[model samples]
Target: MKFKTAFAAAAALTLATAANAQVGPEVGATVYGPEGNTVGTIEAMQDGVVVVNTGTYTAPVPANAFGEGPEGPIVSVTKDQLNAMMAEQEKQMIAARDAALIENATVLTADGVEIGTVTSIDGDNAIVTLEDGPVSLMRDQFATNETGALIVLATKDQLMAALNGGSVEGGEAMEADAE
Candidate 1:
């Protein structure tokens, strides 16, 4: 697989405490860098990862990458560094996604569950034929995982819910379109 490492290495031991002090960074809590500079705020916790909102972008760091500090939870990368890394990662991810998005290709969820088949591609949109029917989705929504498997950055249930709720732009449930 040609996937670049998706995770930042675990934060330095000095910055992280055991198990983030038996808990993890709470949402809205400020995250610090090793030098005690503000990196960002914890926006969410999902699947053992913490989403740190750096204003410019959100970076997904493993929960274990955080350590308790005198002021708050600390991560290894400074604000600027993390933001730059995230930007680079985003470019790489988009490139990988474009490479994998071929007609007839099977798309998988981030956790590796096959979600649908790519029936066609039009400009920046793709039509994936799910169980119900075809749904149009933006190409930006697709990316490859650490194993280079073509996947979206959501769980199967989340994608299904979005399709069912008609929340994804240009995505209409196949059955709903018939009605």
Candidate 2:
């Protein structure tokens, strides 16, 4: 009984101490790894997620993924491991973007409706021939569907509305959600 009581007191004290040592996730704060090594800097925090800039890439990690470390808030992965993973992700993203912006490729609407075909590549713009005329879209506005089909990142009605300078029939409040 004495051993149990002492253990409980010690555990409570440890918890109290740990609770006081928590590192706040703030912008420009250095985040550490489990072994107290530099993981990255917290670039931004929003909606319980922190965007950590690891020099190579900006990674969005859940706030709960961090733990109280000896020196600062610690993420599970090491700096090198996180950098490697981010590098791979960046590469894949570039590849997917490239695949969707090819010339002569069929451009489908966000809802899988056929809209146009890529007629020409003008610098950073992909000139897609829509129903009425050819429209140039930024490279980033192109996307690949689940089956690897090239698509514009907007609906048919949205595209028509933008081109005609009028409200679309089926357009919703399009939030600027970057892919």
Most TM-score-accurate candidate: 1
Candidate no. 2 TM-score: 0.60
Model 1 pairs whose backbones collide: 16-67, 17-67
What RMSD value applies to candidate 1?
12.5
Taking the tens digit of each residue's C-alpha lDDT, what string does model 1 give over 44-78?
99999999999999899999899888888899899
Worst 10 residues of 2 by lDDT: 170-179
Q: Candidate 2 on 90-119: residue-level lDDT in tens?
A: 788668879677788998988999987887
The list of candidate 1 runs beyond 4 A from truth reads 1-26, 45-48, 67-70, 109-116, 130-133, 152-165, 168-179
Steric overlap count per candidate:
2, 0
For candidate 1, the TM-score is 0.61
Candidate 2 residue pairs in clash (backbone atoms < 3 Å)? none
